[model samples]
Target: MDTNQAGPAAEEALARQEQETITQAIAKELGISVKQVRTTVGLLDEGNTIPFIARYRKEMTGELDENVLRDIEERLSYLRNLGDRKKDVLRSIEEQGKLTQELQEQILKAVKLQEVEDLYRPFRQKRKTRASVAKEKGLEPLADWVMEQRRQGQPLEEAAKYIDAEKGVESAELALQGAMDIIAENIADDPTIRSWVRQYTASQGILVSEAKDAEQESVYENYYNYREPVHKMPPHRILAINRGERENVLKVGIEVTADKIHAFILRKLVKGPSPVKELLEAVTEDAYKRLIAPSVEREVRGEMTEKGETQAISIFSGNLRSLLLQPPVKGRNVLGVDPAYRTGCKLAVVDDTGKLLEVAVTYPTPPNNKKREAAAKFKELIAKYGIQLIVIGNGTGSRETEQFTAEVIAEIGDPGLAYLIVNEAGASVYSASKLAQEEFPDLDVAERSAASIARRVQDPLAELVKIDPKAIGVGQYQHDVSQKHLEESLKGVVESAVNHVGVDVNTASASLLSYVAGVNATIAKNIVKFREENGKFTTRKQLQKVPRLGAKSYEQCIGFLRIPGGDNTLDRTPIHPESYPVVDRLFRELGLDVASLGSKEVAEQLQAQDAAELAVKLDVGVPTLRDILESLQRPGRDPREELPLPIFRTDVLKIEDLVPGMEMQGTVRNVIDFGAFVDIGIKNDGLVHISQLSGSYVKHPMDVVSVGDNVTVWVLGVDLKKGRVSLTMRPPSGNDGGAK
Candidate 1:
């Protein structure tokens, strides 16, 4: 074995070690086998998408789902970045000629970038600071004498020798002061002391905040004189405090016990009593207060804020996914209304297939109450298109619009007519988007928004994909989180939702298709272009011919693309092209005809067979076989249809009408950390506090209800002046406080 190692060979050895460590670490953290992480990493390295690996390569990845595969990908990326950072730190330290073997080992063993940076702090090049100036004045020897702690003599004697008038050391007192600066810098730069102090402060420190101006009232008034332990602050509180601080409404600081921190530092540096102990104590105090305290507070707050943002982003991602996957109100002629007082309500009537039949304006409510004219126009449009449902944008004048629509339906006396208010948070954003302009070049912005609102009701996943996920407004503090991370996470959720509900290639827009696994924006646009130049895609194989859609991309994306009522019956299902043979074999072995797929008898027959035996005979994995069977049983099945539909209402309820203990059915508009906001046909959504969510303990609001969930709630109280309603889901308990 060569004692001295360098260059590519040494790099190879280190790379091998790092890779092994990453593999084991990811496995341990994710509670999966190391082999699973390795296999998944290899697949990802080969350009395999998460959806592709999760669905097509089940056996290879030990049957990991898309979420798990994505988690592995995320962790692998982070660890690889950490490894690269460690290598850079090592190189920087080695170049400084200060890298010791123990230091090298410590740096190699460091798990986080923060730890590596801490170890590198001492050797890091600095600007001309007091410490650097002292070192220039030859006071480093005196500083070393203080650190050694073995000599029982005064440090001034040692510091006196370093007093050179030429290099700015004028007097013994100035020399001692210069040495003190060096000693303080050394103590501050020591990785061990910094790490210990940071951990201790984080654990014991109290985060305190006061209102910048207590007389001024705002939403954050509750935080005017708030105090919470740094480590115990919840994610929502962290975000709240951050927002308050940013708005200049609060003064926030971390309060640590100075006595404890000083005692710990003294015990570490001031070993047995020595004459330099007092000097060391003074230097330690100087190091903590002047050099380390501010940075440590910032670092702790940064870490806490990062964790809070991660949590908030995760919640937003989940809510967005749920909202996007809401069941499509198919086969209903929808009338979309963009409510406005000044501009009049923009109305778009879209037929069952989301084709815009007409666009008109209604002044039923507001500045121009053209009741007779607006009602007549609305009635004519409804009768012309045979509208069965109304999709009202939950925007300006929404309550008035809802009331007007309810009256119109009552006047029409149609039993089938009803309305549902859909969250139009990002409709305006989409209307202003280039994609929306390209889709409807002839329409105005508000007209386009009305059309979008209608189409979203028909197919949420398809239409919601057009708007920026951040603008969707499904989560609290979404704007406060890391935008890059939030976008990536919400993108993943969209990708997962899209793949989960395999899209009909001919029907999906470019925005929706872009979220499909292995499909980029360019390819998605090319798909639409190809479909336009050529006719609709009749088979999954047609995707391979699209420009820039190479064999690999096609293979990764084709399974999630469906072509209903196409030439090949299997193409109407999620049964992949490669798996068609297996499916054909399954049908043959079961003595069933493919033409009669999705029929009750055929579905029963397929469901009755043994999937394991069929997998063996078909030579496919059990998971793949089961998926094929599911598709065969119900071709083009939508998972969303099983969820509770949005509450359809022919009548509108006002805040004044809400009485305590009045039970009403409503849809969950959004779920946050503390509780859920339910739309009980009012202008303001009611808050169902976490305590009112259920009879038992609720860890999180999302665990009980998600966005678009239909739940029956009892009104605990109504604040008419404030326009707020308190709702409960625990059967009310017949009390004003609601249920525990």
Candidate 2:
């Protein structure tokens, strides 16, 4: 037998053991079942996407939701990487011939990467320093003598024995200085001491900031003399302070009690009264002030920044999800308006399917003031296109354009005609892009923007996916946070939204298809190309025929790609193609034709049967069986249809029109940590502060409302000078008037 063959097997066994250890750790941290963690880890290791595992592998994961599964995936990756790093560190230490059993155990027991790094600090290679210089001078024996804490003689008297002029120790004092340097380095390198000081400083420190220019009236004025407890500070405030400091507007630092840290270190390093006790005490202070304090401060601030970025990314992700999942305004012929002043109000009339029918420009505000002419042109377009809804971009001159649109509607007396102010944040960016130019070569920037605005209301997901998610304006301090992390999180949000709602394979653009569970940019384009060449896909099986889309991609993606009128009605639903056998058996056992699905008779039959009992009969899990039954009931149903729709209006109101205690209906435009901006048919969206979000205490604005929520708010106050309008969701007192 070849002895080397066992080496590979041994390494594989070791890898498996490490993976099990990480899995067990994650299970304990998340307080989930070990079996669940193991199964999820196995599935993720098998290259199944999070959405696929969450939706399809319920039996393996014990029905963990997407959020939990994602958490598991992140933790698993982190722990596995940490374990690998630990192994590397251990190997390096062992190779140096300095590894001890105690140190090995400590490294193995470390929970965080920081903890492992701290343990490895002393062993880490360093550049030439004072300690290394002293060692180079052959003064290491003197340093060790000082560390021994001999009580029989004075340190300088003991140090004189090691003084050698040739070795650069000219005198006892010089030898003592080098010894103290070694002692300081030793104290600085103690992991236990460093860890304790870090914990103490973090718990007791205050983050203080002072304005660099106290007289300047900037947005950071509130932070001019800010001081907040490090432990209790909010993530937003930390990010704000960090930005303020980065911009040179404020000086920030962590303030901790120096005497307390010094005393603690002295008590740990000094065992008893000795000839070198005083020198050692001074070295302790020098180690902390010169070495430990600065490093610990950076670590604490870095930790805070990381935490703040995490929170900011989470907020952005949630907001993006809500914005992407807004309900589509189906079957509505709409006219889109890109509001402007000096130029003209650009218009694009799109049919219900977002197909542009006409484009024109009319001067409605400022330079021309062609109000009547614009109204006449709008009315003509409305009648010509049979336009049911008007979507106006809330940009420059939006208020005047909306007033003109309202007047046009009122004159026509078409109650069915309503206008909506769509947030056109990235419309211009999209319009000027290569994609937009390719999509519409003849249209100008404003014209393309108008079309995008119209299509946003028709189908928000489809239209918004064309623009970069970061430019969608659903986040706070998005640019200030980690761009890579933010992009990753936003992309994940879009992917989750796309997969959750599913996709119409025939109508979906490559931009939308690229975010599907298993699809990439290349595969998305290939799928669209295949569709264009081969015609509409009639069944999920046809996906495998697309070049570069293999069996794995088809299996991962086919379930989330829908065909409304396909050969298999199950294809129109979220049911996987692999489960057709179970469905066929179900239909045979029930004596029902698959074509009879969603019919009244089938609905009644499904409602009368117990899904759990049927699941056992069909040899499938209850969750899968329930999902199949739901799909059978409502084929090709859009999950977005269940969410609240965008608010529409036939009239416009200025900020001055708002009065205290007057109620009005509004649409949630953007939700942040502090409040929500609501568009209540006004030029400027009103602010619903976190405190005013509900009648009771509210933890976060998102907990009360999300983007696209149609809410009834009372006008609290309006500052027309600053163009600020404050609103509240809470009901007014008995004396206050209601909606006007």
Candidate 3:
């Protein structure tokens, strides 16, 4: 046998087995067929983007959404990592000549990385533990003798023969003690015993926390003396306690009975016992208390932390998706205000197409006291630019800015003129970015931010894409969660949102274009540069001429990149170029041309046909045909238009103006675990606790509400001192839970 060839062959076999296992595992967990998982894996391995596969290759994946595809991708990566770690563990154990058939089987069948680690713990190299020291003193045989309990002799007399003064076994008692220590360490290292102990401790443990300083007043005071069962603790409570513990404001620990765990271990490890029952019982107790108990408690706590973080990340990403998908307030000029206290509010007038036409500064708030001058200037700007909307940053002096803008609109008395306070979380960061500098070289940072605010109303997806999603700030504990995990999940949300609302190739910036199905930053820039050199992209095929945009890239991205008023009308729709032949065949059969698309008569005719029959005639998948038909009818459609638009305020309200039972329309600004904060046309947003979100039980805030939802809420109460309002979606029952 050629040894080199055998090694490569074995590796190949192992890889095949690993891939098969991962495929089956994903199929089971996701409740999909193995064939679908296998096909999806093939597509992913071929370097297809998630959005492309979701939109274009629906038949191959059985019409799974982008979220599921992302889940598959994440699970596949995790399984591959687990597989590699198992290989490393198996090799190390085999090299030490301790790998057994049962151990190998257990390692191979392990699904989670933690399970594999647990199985491998026994073989891992130790750092001079009691067992290793006893072994150095030649106490292993005595320990084995004591464990079997079969010998009809005194254990200490057997241990006395191995006593060596120089080796630290100076007496019979000392030798017996060393033997018991070895026995205890051995029991702790046994994978079966350790697993049982961990499971028992977790099920029976009570998680408790205490205040480090009882007199300290802080946000975590509620968690200072908290107690919950380890199994029933909620994710938010876990996260709160963890944060308090990290801040050194609380001491947290798990309480489990040591005796129960020791008894369990005894039943598992000891059978046909004889004279040494007392010795074995003591050894088992020592095994649990001295080693396994503390280690397992820490592992349980770590597991809880992981669960909490995962829940937080999921909620954060879900809220981000909702925030990004807000409807665009299109085809209107906007006056954007970046409110401030001292330097004056920076204002920018943006035209319908998001071009900055003018910039100004006005200080209507205190100290500046330029309300008269600012009102006149704002009125002039609104009339001069034909502004239909006003957007004020929800930062310092925002309420005053909004109040002033509303008064100016009232004076003009245009019911059509409305103002909205937009969350300006990352405006400053985006303004200082290199991309922003290039977009507005002459404008100062605050002026650029004002322009960004205006454009964000024009298209939230386009403008928000310019900033990092982490900075967009529609999340809770985002900083405390895993940065890498949060970034990856949010990136997926952004990509899904961008692809959901296809971009116009001629109008989209590099930041927007980069998130298209197959487009990247470099290629996105290349597309722009190509447009600059070549004027406008008249057709989808023109994209192929751009540098680094190959056949695969074009196939993936061309369907998502729209071209309005281009030479080819079909290019304006989302129909992929590859399907143009099928479209032409249908239209030709109907005695019509593509030029007649979007007409009311054509839309009715297309809608009247049977989708299944037409799909068969065109030799296309049913999903693809339906999409083409929809796109042809409504060319250049944006998905955001179907969603509710952000509620605008023609007048502003103050905390003092609110009263219980007052019904008002609001926009959901942020949804956290406890509740959602709603912007109710006031300076401060009000809280709608999860219990009050609806007249039913709520699992979490994300279940019933999302960011940017336009809802009708009734005020439950108000605390003028704290500047807080309590709200409920359900009819007022005259009950409220004050903000906790």
Candidate 4:
């Protein structure tokens, strides 16, 4: 049968089989029913977004939340892609006339793309090599005879048969050498052997790294002489060693004994004692040293890197979500300060609504030495604008600026004036952006940064959306990972956060609205334009009139967008428009008007009604009814308010003031794999290592704290010269004067 004769019909049938295989695999891997997997896949295939399907298609998907739905969608795509790659591999091998039933079955059973590639490697065409050259010289027959490993007569005489001078096989020795080369290549290329070797080495190998120049000081000093088991090495250590190796500060490799690999290969391939056993033994050792070990080492390192990148991206995603969802310091006039030394501090005061009311500059540190004058000027501006909160950017000269602000507030004798230290990671990025330029054409970069600093405290989600997620310094080694993958994951995180906390359609900036369930950048801009041209959206129905926002887009996005004080009261809540009739019926049954939502009487009635009975009465799923009831309880409530608030300080603490056993309040600035970095009112943030995160075992530091958690940490140690602070969240022992 000609493999080329596989027609479209056959191809289509194969594709259908492949898709079914992928569906079954996903269902088992995700621990969900096959029906749920199939329905979710169909929804995704039909262009339904994760947020939309999670929120609206509860009846079809069994109420899978956003995270589960996203996991299923991601795994579905990966498995389908894996299946496609398998087909391509099969076709390529068949085209080469090397496809066997056993090989095909192995390829079909493979789950990972790496496994498929390993299976296809031997048949893959190669550049000019010793193996190819030997085969070209017609020595392959001898190699095959050697691979047979039968108790044959003398192998030298057998090699003599292939020794033809005309074909460049000048002597029996030359022919034997070429055959040995071919045999070694065959041993190295065997898929089964490679798989076992890879797995064994990964489990038993030790990753060793040593300093290239031990005397030189570098950030990788701790890793200069590091050795850890490959299977037990943590992701951060792997990434750090990789970075060190790439920077030429260290040499890294996986160390495994040749004896172990040798025994494994011989056990699998060697059948019995033969005349050519010694030759085969030498060939196997040569294959491992020259061909197999290097390849397997590369594979193991790549796997480690990929795993590290995945963990780093997950940490970044979680931290970004927590940071973006930090509760807004509502209804406070904030004065933002972009601190600097040679250049004066840039200040911008914004109203409770994030409207810029004032901008000023004062030299507070170094060369200028105008502390008194700066304090007097800031106090005057605070009095003039009635500033209730002062946000200082945690950047250059931040400590000095914070101290100055505290002194000025105390001098003014205004107990209402408090200060907070904002992360300000991407403020400069946002300030120099085109969006910032259009927003404040007249202000300089520093002034714009001050405005952003102020707006972040007022509304983090709205302001953070204007900057790229990558620029925000939340994750470790974000710049070293795959940018495309990182960006995709971060974008999903932003979307999840935005949809989780509904947006205000009337007042949301294009940046914020762009992250809604179905609204893209173009549509978000159009929505803002519509609002600017027409009036505020009075009802969710008005979204239909927005050009380019069609029915499908409205259905996907309307549930995530809120219109406070709109003509329809349901517009402000999370209840989908399709469920409005159900809510109306419930309202009538409860003898409450739609306008009386969130009223005391209505709240009482809702509390008294049985949710199960109410769900049946409304003819909606219990999930939808429960969500509606939650929305009614608090219309347009921000979920972030339920979490801890940012720590505010009326006085400043320098690094010199810290001592062992001193306890202080701080906010979690960043969470990483090894520990959490907390701001303890100093020049540098303190590290609460994973061991110190809790009294018991913790799988991850993020499980204990988040980016905005206000925790009480005791100072374990402080290095004033190095500007390092070590902290512990675990309460002190009773013997230590009951220190917190």
Q: What is the lDDT of every predicted structure here?
A: 0.89, 0.88, 0.88, 0.89
Question: Candidate order by TM-score, highest to lowest?
Answer: 1, 4, 2, 3
Per-candidate TM equals 0.97, 0.96, 0.95, 0.96
Candidate 3 lDDT tens digits, 626-707:
8888888878788789887888789878889888998888889999989999998888899998888877688888878889
Q: State the displacement of the C-alpha of residue 669, model 1, in Å, after optimal TM-score superposition.
A: 0.4
Candidate topping TM-score: 1
Candidate 3 stretches with Cα past 4 Å from truth are 1-14, 272-275, 732-740
lDDT of 2: 0.88
What local lDDT does model 1 show for residue 497?
A: 90
Residue range with the least summed lDDT across 10 consecutive positions in model 4: 731-740
Query: Which residue ranges in model 4 land beyond 4 Å of their true spot?
Result: 1-16, 164-166, 733-740
Model 2 agreement with the true structure over 385-451: per-residue lDDT tens digits: 8999999998898888888888888999988889888899899999999889988899999999999
How many backbone clashes are present in model 3?
A: 0
If candidate 2 were superposed on the true structure by all CA atoms, what would the RMSD be? 2.6
Error of 3 at 376 (Å): 2.9
Question: Where does candidate 1 clash, by residue pair?
Answer: none
Error of 1 at 516 (Å): 0.9
How do the residues 1-740 of candidate 1 rate in per-residue lDDT, one tens digit apiece? 12145777887887787788999999999999999999998999999999889888998999998889989999899999988887788888877788889998999889888998999898888999999999988888877877788756767777778778899888888999988998788888989899999999889999999999999999999999999999999999999999999999999999999878888888888878788788887888899999989999999999889989988998898899899899989999999999999899999999899998889998988789888998999899889989999999999999999999999999999999999899999999999999989888999999999999998889998899999999999998999988999989998898899998888899888988998888999999999999999999987888889999999999899999989889999888877799988877887888888788879999999888798987888888998888888888988889888876788999988898888989988888889999999998889999999999888788998888889888889988888889999999988454332211
Clashing pairs for predicted structure model 3, backbone only: none
